[model samples]
Target chain A: MADHQQKSDKTVHRHEALQKKLALKEERKHHNVSFIMMILLTLVAFYAISSDKIGDSFAVMFILVLAVVQVFFQLYIWMHLSHKGHEFPIWGMASGILIAAITVASLMGMIWTS
Target chain B: MSTHASHKKRTGLMDWLTTVDHKKIGILYLLSGGFFFLIGGLEAILMRIQLIKPENDFVSAEMFNQLLTMHGTTMIFLAAMPIIFAFMNAIVPLQIGARDVAFPYVNAVGFWLFFFGGVLLNMSWFLGGAPDAGWTAYAPLSTVSAGHGVDFYVLGLQIAGAGTLAGGINFLVTIINMRAPGMTFMRMPLFTWASFVTSGLILFAFPALTVGFFLLMFERVFGAHFFNADMGGNVLIWEHIFWIFGHPEVYILILPAFGIISEIVSTFSKKRLFGYSAMVFATVLIGFLGFMVWVHHMFTVGLGAVANSIFAVATMAIAIPTGVKIFNWIFTMWGGQIRFTAPMLFAVGFIPTFVMGGVTGVMLSVPAADYQYHDSYFVVAHFHYVIVGGLVLGLFAGLYYWYPRMFNRVLNDTLGKWNFWLFFIGFHLTFFPQHWLGLMGMPRRVFTYMSGQQLDTSNFVSTIGALLMGAGTIVLFINIIISASKKNIASADPWDGRTLEWAMPVPTPEYNFAQTPLVRGLDALYVEKTAGNGKMTPAEPVGEIHMPNGSILPFIMSVGMFISGFGFIYANWYAAGGGLGIVLITMFLRSVIDDHGYHIHKEEVEADIKGGRA
Candidate 1:
């Protein structure tokens, strides 16, 4: 009877240890998610009041801002761009975006002027 | 490696016609794209002939406009982009050590969509007229364009655009999910980097085009006034949206060329790319900045000076990154054992020509200055300088570089030199005089000019140049056919290259690798070679390989849209309504269908590998 009681105590202790580890991970995740959401919400609120062209300008801005956040989310979570093992594609894709931006902006400027 | 039992499972033209192999799919892309390139070239030649002399009357004014429109659209969308994609599709998955692209069936579908769309667009010629709407198919004019011309533009691009978007998604997924063990992101080749970025641009940019095309359809066919000025609708909005898509469209076209150039330059020069990280950073910066500057295209349309000035500066900002890239290329060639192969010559030539293009681009960015340059031969000159000097040159360079790998035969150097010089001299001859004409106040798109307008001589020169360019293009075809027929197989490492692609065999196998390669570093093959390891270490054991089967469903899906296209154009209520119904039904069927695909048995695979039929 005493040995059986000892085994039960050990099992309980192991379960507690696992629970603590899981709790710590969840806490970190929550903190990060809230931080991102809060920043995004704050920006949207500020931009909503700041712009005169609220419907079009701020709306576009908001969409773009949202897209930026989404890209970050995609890179980190969906694309795993931040995954430790995936340096080449991450870097390559990033460069591609950079060059693409220049091409669009330059042409836009030229065409707008022309 | 030909000892495998399944090594000789099938061999025939039928097998190739029905094959779902990524390599084969890539070859199909090449053949189809090549065919279109020829057609576009012919269009270019016709355009040149029309402009040979002032009041030449070689072709009708209306015909000239359509020719110009189709020429631009076909070359950029159907010819260049798809041909580049052919290479990317053939090589990228292999470079990354994957068995196939993320979605093989979609890959096949994408190619077919392009093929059919190009055909559909061409069929407009037989129907009545071709799309006279400029490649951009700008709003007011496009909506007002009579006949079925605009209809072809809208429907053809939409169909093809869907295919292109699918291709982008597939590449993105493949790169994301399929890298082999130790093949980290930084280790991928610059070309793959380009494909990834190009795909991303396609993803975002195409949707804007989709929106634009639909609005155009509404106005032209359905009697909507989205772009009709009299109906409280703004035509400029269409311009905004079109350029929004259109401006980035150049990047979509050129950045991949830059990627190819980087690979070729480094390989032939026998050195690592100078400023590799910086080059990467610049590419990304360019892509990000692409969306910010579409307003520049609208300066002459009167967006006010403040908007114009900001756009000018934004436009100029692009040059800094471009200049950096140019410097990087120059330095890449510096202090290296540069082999002046046909590809290398093109790369070297690109530096000066592209830089000149860049300078002019910056000059055009100035709103006040563009007032002088806009709608003139100068504008044509600047764009031709960029597109021809930058993208087309890079493509030629890449073709020469990868020719051996693609066809297993080195393009004859003597013929290549002829091709390059004729193209080079002819290009300069054709465009140089245009700058002078623009300076002399010649407006573009004018079908004819009166004598003593002082434009005749330069125009004549321009026509002569165009003819030379045509002759050069013909020579390129000749070189391709002769070399292809010779069938001298490319070595595994044809250029003594740095990237992973050179590590693989010529005529790469269906499975890509019998086993996925375990990459240790950048230029992983080089590392293996130096280590006296003759073969790449396989990351995993050979086993049954899961692959998607070839299907007729994608073709059917496209045909549904192709048929519905007429409905939208004819504006027959039944056709539009029922035609759309067909599309909806196809989608529904596609979703409901269960496609588990197929798998090659391990025994067959082993036999193939042993026989080297893999």
Candidate 2:
């Protein structure tokens, strides 16, 4: 009878542990934070464009930097790319970016020279 | 599903239409690709006949243009790509020890789309006329060309390109996610490695073609002005986009051929591939560099000295990795117990032929020399040498090597040798003279030439060579028929195979592996053989096998797309609407349908094993 009671207790403990993992409340919190940050970044870009306080080139550069940051957040936080076991996909994406950069750069060169 | 019911359902023509088995789909690809290959070959022969004599009037100039265009389009898109897909489907899953591709439904969709798209493209010949502005289909000529020829090119390629893209994505995900336990990237067969890189190329390169075709479609069908220089659009844009896709496409075709040769050479030589890690690196490097060299094709377009120099340099840089591969193959054969099988013969022959093609390729890569070589028979000879000699030879070798795996029979060896020698000699005979012809000032894409222009003898020899090739193909067909009729069942490990694929039964089961294999090292099967165990160690106990159910939705979806393609070409809005409606409805049904699929019990698997042995 004592052994049966201990086994039942262990089962309950394992169930609670699984519940804790499945809740994912921490992940949800991080997602909310990232989402808000994205919106704020967008608003800042809008303000920089609308206000004349900054120079046009500075504003454009600022927005571009912000855009790059947003993309990181999107990939890492939203898409869970920061999580483990995504190395191959990350490699594929990086290669794609490299090729795209080359293509765009070449096209720009062609147009500029022409 | 009851075993008897499932068995009954799997036996008929209807099953083929609805089946989602990778092997079955592979057969479909082979059959369709073979059919189109014949059509393309016929076109080639007719062109040869026209050029057999100077000032020949066998075919008009207009018809000749159509034939050349169709020959290029059909062979590249319809024949070569699908045949590559055939081997990929038949082998990759088994090589990786996966039950099925990552997306079985999407795989079915891909095949059907390709089929319907090919049918739609060919339908142009019967309806009005085929596309005649060259398979390249440069902007102004394609845009201003009268009739619906270019329309078919635009729509057909659009649909087929979608299928190719889907297949590419499917392979990427499958390789990434579905490798067996202990099967690291380094442990993969060279064929799978090459395929992985090819898939990556397809993913990146095909989109350029898609965008180019979309622009053409809009110009031709919707009266858009994307390519209209008069409307302030650039004509060179089309050339840029086409080659961006076109250059990598050649790699996409050849890389898998390289993979096939690697497998065949290693198997026949009774040794592992030499410089295995370097081979992998070179394959990836080739794929990466493929994108940087598209401008080599456009050197004559006056991209200016700077652009031409950069592009030329980049193009020549590709030869490094390709040379690495070539040397690796030769080293693979060095000091090994070489069996000189039909497949090995092809592999050995491929080396010199591809090298010759590559030498010419580098010669043409020089921008100044390209000015002399552009739009000449030299360019034609160079490509045919690579395509026919490299890709086609590799394909035939792969067929001989894997025929026993695909079908439970061995192809007749003597006949196989005849097929090889005939095709090899014939291939050289047909194209070698063309190189001289190009230097002799005979232009390409022309229907006739004046008498006594010094082109007759070479052209005559080329025609005879083409006829010999035709005879060689006939011998292959007869060999296939005889092998099938004789029922010469092959052993499971025919050729003392090295890979995971040969571990399965002759007629591979639906689940492929009865239990998932535990891959211990490179050439997993060979490792076991050396260890005195001739079979793989199963990673899991025999259990119920879960399989995706076959569905006809993919076929219906393709038919619907075919109808919509016609609707677009003919400007029939209602037909378009109806076709799209059918597609959308089927998609909705598929979404709503909860097909958890069926399972094969462990008892059934046991029974199959026992019966096969019996």
Candidate 3:
């Protein structure tokens, strides 16, 4: 009877251990932090565009830089791009950005030239 | 469960209509693409006949315009791209040691959409005239053109382009997620690597085309003024968007061809690809540079010197990576045993033919020279050299290489060689003189020319060459029919193949590998062979194989889109609404239905292993 009781206790402990492993506490914490940061970044972008203190050119540049940062945060943190098993996806996204940048930049150049 | 019996009951037409199997879908792509290819070839022959003698009076000017436009559209969008997709579907999963693509149902939907879209486009010929503004369909011409021709072009391409986008995403996810254990990115076959890059190009580049087509549709159908200069629209925007997609589209067609050549050359040479890492880097680099060079096509459009030069330099920059690939192919064969099989013959021929195309491409990139070459036979020759010599030859090579794997028979080598020599010589004969013709001052897209203008001899030669090419195609058809009737079963590893695909049984089992292979290195099968094992180590124990259930929704959805496409083209609102309703209702059914799929039990798998010679 004592041995049976001990086995039951061990089984319950293993179940709890498995749940803990599956829970992803650290990842959840990271997500929460990243969410707050994203919100803060959005507010800053709005302020940078609206504020009279900043000049026009600087405001444009600042907002653009901030927007890029927000995108990185959204992709790498919130979307779990920084996690394991995401290397190929990261490569895909990076190449996509590179193409998009080149396309837009050349279009701008063409517009300027024309 | 009795699911196996139910599956067996689904034989005949219903089986194909609802199949989610990659192999069947691949065959569908091949058949449809081949049909379009023949149509496109007929158009080419008719155009050649019209040009056989100056002022031949064979076809009218209007007819000639329609023929050229339809030929280019059908060949690029319908024929070449679908055929590429066919090979991709047939080989990539097997190459990567996966049972199916990441989304098998989506794959089916893509094929059906492409098929229906092609049908919608071709139906324009009977309903009215075909699109007459050339395949590029540049505005203000396209936007200002009369009739429902451009409308068909817009709607058909929109549906087909969406299908292509879905296919691209499917491949991207499949390659990223479905590789066998220990198959690293570096370990992937060259063809898969090329496919990966091509998918990236498709994902990024196709959206531009989609947006461009939508604007054209709205402008033409609803008078939206997106390209109507009379209502505050810039025509150059259309140019920008189209070439942005167009330049990359060419790469998307050619990159897989490059990959095929690499595979064939390496296999036939009995050597590993020299400078494999460099080849991968070059592919990515070329894909990257492809976007920047779009303006090269627009240099003669008055984009100005600075813009032209920038695009010119970017265009030339692509040649560096392409050159890297060319050298790597040559070096791969440098001191290795070379087999002269039909595929290898095409591969060997591709080197010089593609180089000629590439050289002319560079020459045309020069802004000053382009003024002379643009809209001339030189430009025509250049692209044919690339598209036909590079892409078409690559398709032929890939077909020969993988025919044994797909069907359980080898194509007759003697017939294959005849197909190769005749097509190769005919290709050169047809296009080679056109370069001189362009230099001699003959413009492209003309219905007729004055006799004794130095264009007669060349045009005559080109027509004869086209007939030769036609003969070659007939020979190929006869070969396929003869081979099919013979039912000469092939061994699994035909050609002493180097990749994991050859490890599977001939007439590859529906589940692909019975046990997911544990890939240990690049050319996994080659590695095992060298280690004296002659077979892959099984990655998992024998177990039940879970397979997705086939559904007819994809076909029905495509048919709905097809009906709507026609309705939109003809401006029939009620029909459009009905078609869209069907599509939405089908989509809803797909969402709510719970299809858990079925599994092949371990006992069945064991029986298969015992009964089949894998």
- Tens digits of lDDT, candidate 2, B87-172: 99999999998999999999999999999999999999999999899999998999998899989988898888899999999999
lDDT per residue, candidate 3, A3-49, as tens digits? 99999999999999988877688778878998898889889989988
What tens-digit string does per-residue lDDT give for candidate 1 at B97-192?
888899887887788778777887888888889999778787788888889988988888888888888898899889888988998878877788
lDDT of 3 by residue, B1-614 (tens): 44544444367999999999998898889999999999999999999999999888888998899999999999999999999999999999999999999999999999999999999999989987999999999999999888898899999999998899999999999998999998999999999999998998999999999999999999987779987778888899999999999999999999999999999999999999999999999998888888888888888899778888888988988899999999999999999999999899999999999999999999999999999998899999999999999999999999889989887889988999999988999999999999999988899989899987888899999988888888888888988899999957988988988998899887899999999999999889999999999999999998889898899999999999999998888889987888888899889999998787788888999898898833
Individual DockQ of the candidates?
A: 0.09, 0.61, 0.65
Query: Per-prediction TM-score, please?
Result: 0.85, 0.95, 0.94
Which wins on TM-score, candidate 1 or candidate 2? Answer: 2
Q: Largest lDDT belongs to which candidate?
A: 2
- Per-residue accuracy of model 2 over A1-114 as CA lDDT, tens digit each: 999999999999999998888768878888999999999999999999999899999999999999999999999998889888988879988999998889879977885467
Best by DockQ: 3
Residue B191 of model 3: what lDDT? 96
Lowest lDDT sum, 10 consecutive residues, model 2 chain B, at: B1-10
- Answer with 2 or 3, whichever has the higher lDDT: 2
What ranges in model 2 sit over 4 Å off? A1-32, A51-62, B1-8
User: Which residue pairs does candidate 2 place in steric collision?
Assistant: none
Q: How well does candidate 2 reproduce the true complex, by DockQ?
A: 0.61
Could you tell me the TM-score of chain B in model 3?
0.98
